[model samples]
Target chain A: MMLEILTYPDPRLKEPSTTVETFDEELRNFLSNLEETMRAGPGGVGIAAPQVGRFQRIAIVDVSSHKKVTKHHGRLVLINPEITDWDGFEIAREGCMSVPDYTGNVIRATHIKLTAQNENAEIKYFEMEGYEARAVQHELDHLDGLLFLDRLVSRRHDLFQRKTHQKKK
Target chain B: MKNWFMLALVGQDRVGIVAQITDALYRGGCNLGEASMLRLGTSFTMMMMVNTQLDENTLISVIQPTAEKLGLHLHLDQIEGELHPHPEPDVKIVVHGADRAGIVAQVTGELANAGLNILDLETGVGGSDKKPFYFMQIEGNATQGMEALQLALEKLKETLQGNIDINLSPLETFDL
Candidate 1:
């Protein structure tokens, strides 16, 4: 079953999610629903568990379909995701499902070494760079109850209209 | 029983202006709503929507002294409880080109004339001083529909001699 994506000001979204301690059938089913919800969105590149009203440290990112993404590892379901180390920084416009109708320019690390658990509770680690890295970072922000607006470089200058600034597909 | 008031704080940029004023409000039990603070050129500007049971006279008296001590110009205007005119901008317009005067006036004037409401507008000038660049973005509501508004803005953009990107559809956001 596809899950409902929570919108902004829905106080539940702000609640810092609990870490996933067990990898059971329920978690698998929820992850599947997350994948479905992400794909259902037109040009959706990623999604998080808290967005669906589940306060858990789980997010999924897939940038392979984003024309500019040259290298990607397909669907990435990051459970209890943690960014061990990051390098470099770049400012880019970002939009979130929870905050409809607004997008902001946010500064994020260009490269990241993220550690997360898989469906079988196996710990996995990967080094991601460029668009894939950016997508992963955006999804991770949800777990911390922070939106692109909160991380804007300058609310006055960096916040932009996501629909028009679609220079990237 | 809550009363609403709009407050403006404008003066030389300082470190404690917000802290000083917010402390005053906290002492008087005023809840801050929407607020925008900015620093432009030499002056720092702040505007806030405050709600409290305190009367205008009493609230002003409490804040006025602290504001004066902070060397900030303060103005307070009571907003009627029922006369709220909040307009949410559904369209986003971005303009970029040569820097000069009247860009804002012309663009906003036309929008107003078209019955569109400007929700938020932010503009800046950058590039070499010899050849400055102007950039503007406005979140607005175009009651005339998307196509109509797009055509109207297109004409204005052409006339204004700049690149204007009009995003009529509300942007979609995703979480997680």
Candidate 2:
């Protein structure tokens, strides 16, 4: 079943999710719903479980089919992921399904080396950059129950109209 | 507490728009606090923060008809509640260069190495092949004990080979 996308200011979006202790059928199903929800939302590249009314420590990211941007390819199911190291800073415009009708310019660690448990229950460390890295950081923030608004630049110059500034896509 | 309402109005530009809206506010017992208006082409846009603690319903009701009669699209909401200001300092950086490969990676790579938190950023490429302008605006805060902020910005300026300017300033807010 496709997950329902949550909009901004919904208290459920702010509740810290419980960690997934085991990779089982339920976890796999949650991951699939995440994929579906991400694809369903307008301009969505990643989504977390909390965004779909489930406060579970899980997120899924995929930027492969997003126009000319070449990012880390494939579906990334991050179950209790954590950043181990970062290599650079990249600033980009970010939008969220929960925060409808607004997008902000956010600075994020551009290159990240992190570890996460995938669907197969294998713990893996991966290094990602470009669009993929931005997507990962955004989704991970959702797992912590923090909306992008919480980390926004807190300045007018920090936000923008997404339609006028959309990158070549 | 002063319960102020922020109202935005958009409609064709002509005389009497302001007087009409303010007249309704006067009748409704709302006092204007802060206001700004501008003309966009044939349309005029106005925004005001009106104090209405005693009777919000009356203020909204009075202005609602004025807006309708004037063919204006009006929106009214309570002023944003008190928000704790972020204490960290901020800087704005602009990166511009040829639209080439790995420009963002090269610049952001330096930012990551320095442990700065990017608060906001936007990037785009324009112009033509002979003279392309890859522009980006980055707002970030530096980590403690890092090199001088200017020094770090200058270092990025040199590394990316893009014309860079860094401005350290307080937080900002404005309407479109």
Candidate 3:
């Protein structure tokens, strides 16, 4: 099924949407739509409910194919996921589907162990690092209406335009 | 909300660097954002993005003194409006090697010589007793009438003398 895509500055992009208490068909279907929408977004690595015009506590993350996965590849469907543990301070460039056309560096935990329910309603936990951790954190921030711009290190440098030349040897 | 700038302070490592600089930012009505403070041998390096609600045009003037007071070489830049379009739009290059002296200088110098504007760069240096590696991603926009980024690639390779690797590609945005 087709999913709705929310563009930048949409209020629905803010305000952590309500939680998905029931692991019902509707919730599963919404999750599917989120995945589809994420795949369709340019440079999209993850997407939360708020980004897809949904207010449910759900997000689909597939950092598997990203440059810095550093782990196995697969999609993660977080249903009411809570960050149970986080450690270390890292400054990484982050962007969002909700706030398109902008990227900024934000300080986040280098490592994160999160807990959430899978499609089967079974609680699952995962430990992620590097880009995976950063991607998950970015998606989770949407659950609270927080954009990477809001957490940007400073306003001086918005994510600069993508460089056209490769680095010199 | 206050617009912020990232201040990178690099100098001989010493005590109270963070405190003193932060105090100045606070007094100047600037808000501190994410920062990484560390000691690289004898030198201490701090990179922080700071924000302030002060008028856009007046931000640099106010922060100039704070930067001087802290003895920091400051770089204040803005991310707004349309960027100047590059006259030449189809050139790219990549750099990777072991971390050592003159890496940034040597690479940036090539871009300068070619009259190419660097659009983006990501450099990572990592090593230990067991392994050593350096990675750099550079995207460049060439000047008009200069489609031969390959020429610059050869020059860069010769300049590095086999210590590094260079790859050339067409202009494209990874958006990562």
Candidate 1: Cα lDDT at A53: 91
For each candidate, how many residue pairs have backbone atoms clashing (under 3 Å)? 6, 4, 16
- lDDT head-to-head 1 vs 2, winner: 1
Q: DockQ: which candidate is best?
A: 1
Better of 2 and 3 by lDDT: 2
lDDT per residue as tens, model 2, B8-71? 9999988999999999888887778657776766999998878765566666688989898888
Residue B117 lDDT, candidate 2, scale 0-100: 78
Once superposed on the true structure, which residue ranges of model 1 sit more than 4 Å away at CA?
A: A1-26, A29-57, A60-136, A142-150, A157-169, B80-90, B113-115, B126-133, B161-172
Question: What are the per-residue Cα lDDT tens digits for candidate 3 across B1-176?
Answer: 33656667777666777787777668768876666777665777887767777665576666566556656665666433232232333455667787777877887776667677776566766677556677677655776324445676688788789998877666432222
Name the regions of candidate 3 deviating beyond 4 angstroms: A155-169, B1-107, B113-116, B119-176
Q: Per-residue error at B140 for model 3, in Å?
A: 6.0
Candidate 1 per-residue C-alpha lDDT over A2-105 given as tens digits, one digit per residue, 9 for 90 to 100: 88988888888778888899889988998898999988875578998898998899998988787656888888989999999999987655767777655655
Cα deviation of A94, candidate 1, in Å: 6.6
Question: What shift in Å separates residue B110 of candidate 2 from its native position after superposition?
Answer: 35
If scored against the real structure, what TM-score would every candidate get?
A: 0.63, 0.51, 0.53
Summarize candidate 2's per-residue lDDT along A95-157 as a digit string, tens digits: 677876556557788789989888987898899987788888888888888877787673333
